[model samples]
Target: MPAILDDFPVLTPVTDEDLALAVQAVRVHAPEDWPHGTLCRSERVPYPCRLARWGGVTLAAAGLTDDQVSALVGTDA
Candidate 1:
């Protein structure tokens, strides 16, 4: 039987387009100096910012590993 994770598409080796979309999503949704430390509050964040954060979370949940996510953000995820 196939594993549940297998049911979801895996973005193996990630791609430039993926990174672009993530960045764009964050830029369009999130506010300047967004995603601050734990001190940050969600309710204060913009709707689009929340959506962008959700999008990244969704991608990670789908199958994107920390490394892959890091590549997208140009950091060590």
Candidate 2:
């Protein structure tokens, strides 16, 4: 069981294009202060919208920590 789990194949391999797009999504979807509460700056949905979450997950899967993601988010600003 352990071997099977360890050897499990990745269904979708991460590519440079994917990473770039994820980074863009993360940066563009950054949260903003709304009169009611936080929301996504790009799509204007709630903060940490689907695209942003997907980017964060992709970055994490690519070995970036939460701090790293936060730093990445701040890099453009």
Candidate 3:
């Protein structure tokens, strides 16, 4: 098994469009999440799954390690 994904869920990476949207999601929501209203995912995690999904994509775009990304913002799965 690839060591980077050893303990993570079996999820596909976020797409380019998803990543762009995720950047928007993070910009519009992070540090504060009211913009997303009740549907916002931050009610639980510090950076909700949706936001994290986008962040993951951004990290991937930047060519970071999966473990590094997970360690930084965690996975969407």
- In candidate 3, what are the lDDT values of residues 1-77, reduced to their tens digit? 57853333313465666555545554444443455443335434445455555554565765667676444443342
Ranking by lDDT: 2, 1, 3
How close is every model to the real structure, measured as TM-score?
A: 0.37, 0.75, 0.32
The top-ranked prediction according to TM-score is 2
User: How far is 34's C-alpha from truth in model 3 (Å)?
Assistant: 22
The segments of candidate 1 whose C-alpha lies over 4 angstroms from its true place after superposition are 1-20, 27-48
lDDT accuracy of residue 5 in candidate 1:
22
Could you give candidate 1's per-residue lDDT for residues 1-77 as a string of tens digits? 55742323436454666656655554445434445533212344544344466547555645777677656655544
Clash pairs for candidate 2: none
Model 1, global lDDT: 0.52
Clashing pairs in 1: none
Distance (Å) between predicted and true CA of 13, model 2? 3.1
What is the Cα-based lDDT of residue 18 in candidate 2? 74
How good is model 1 by TM-score?
0.37
The lDDT of model 2 is: 0.77
